[model samples]
Target: MKRSNIRIIGVPEQQEEEQGLENLFEEIISENFPEVGKKKVTQAQRVPKKMNPQRPTPRHIILTMANVQDKERILKAARERWKVTYKGSPIRLSNDFSTETHLTRKQWMEIYKVMQSKGLNPRILYPARLSLKIEGEIRRFTDKKRLREFISTKPAMQERLKGLV
Candidate 1:
């Protein structure tokens, strides 16, 4: 599958009429990521999702970047910073993956959270590697079988999984 150029989420929707999305993108990049050039942005749009009318929140901002290096830089910066806030709310920025990959990563979300709650900072790497930081060292599991093997080594993880696994 082809890698997506760019996607940014959790950026607050500014309710200014004169300041369009393009302008907002420029503003965000300038404010949070000065190293990234706004001119590299090829396409930017809001990803639609179901909203609550009584308490509507910001829709995700997705973009296509012309420069792959710039995109990687932004993503890396965002990850290092953890949460980028706008209007007192947190925002997320990430790479846009193909549907299959996205769904595949999503399926193991419960395990991800379980590992996190156990003081393991686990992350799913591109093309699907389950990486976790444990005891000041980073360990990665290449596939589900390897991940399962690693988890089986941890009785705590097994106890927590119960039926979830």
Candidate 2:
């Protein structure tokens, strides 16, 4: 269900209604990926988080693509291109993960980077599972405790990842 949706950040706020947002979405696609013209958007709206008076950036827009393939195509393009902008200002496109899943992934980022730097080949699987390549084999961990246990088994990893797990 979340696969078809994307969250767009850094777009300036405007008083325009939903139709305006749809047009902006189109503009975003055209600006970043001209070949991927006019993909169907089932829904487009700003996220419902309460506005903070001190924050300068606008709330992110959550876009739902009618077809998951289109979403995938755009995401692939964004990854390859490395810069997706709208109206000359930088914007970002990413999967619309639930709060819990997003937080879980966020928690793994420090370890992910350390593993990556050490050439562990870490990957964050969908909905928040961490996978690592260890000695030509793949190992997947569903939670930090499991990962901690696995790391504890390896003396080298235990020393390197001390206090992180």
Candidate 3:
């Protein structure tokens, strides 16, 4: 159900209400994803602020796309583009994930960063899987223990990721 949903961050509070979220979404599409042209949004609303109410950053906008394909396209465009902005101000787009899924993904971030610094191409797959390219083959790891076990065989890789694993 949440697959087609995305969260928009950094848009100021009440900005969507002035012109409407649907219009803002359309503008964002047109601005950052000209190829996408126009797409439909099934639902659009601002979620409650996650941090202190006094903070300057506004509440996140939850956008349910008309279909999962549209969501994927938008995300792909966001990735290819250096940055996604609305009216010159910067904004961020990300998949709307459940708390568990988000936390699970966070667990792999340290290792991911380490691998990235080592010049290894690392990608985090959907639902908390880590992918790394060693030599010419790509390895996918769902958990840290399994990743550690596999890295143990590779002395160089094991050495590179000693304490992290």
Give the candidate number with the greatest TM-score: 2
Candidate that scores best on lDDT = 3
The digit string of per-residue lDDT tens for model 2 on 84-141 reads 8887889999988878888999998999999888777899998899998887889999
Alpha carbon lDDT of each predicted model: 0.72, 0.87, 0.89
List where candidate 3 sits over 4 angstroms from the true fold. Answer: 52-56, 98-100, 109-127, 131-139, 151-165
Could you arrange the candidates by TM-score from highest to lowest?
2, 3, 1
lDDT of 3 by residue, 93-141 (tens): 9999988898999998998999899888899999899998888999999
- Compare candidates 2 and 3 on TM-score and give the better one: 2
- Work out the TM-score per prediction: 0.63, 0.70, 0.67
Q: On residues 36-154, what C-alpha lDDT tens digit does candidate 1 reach at each position? A: 55646777788866778986767777777776777788788778777676556666777888778778788767778877777667898777678877557788876678777766887
* Model 1 weakest lDDT span, ten residues long: 9-18
Candidate 2 clash figure, as a count: 0
lDDT comparing candidate 2 with the true structure: 0.87
Error of 3 at 59 (Å): 2.7
Task: Tell me the number of clashing residue pairs for each predicted model.
Answer: 0, 0, 0
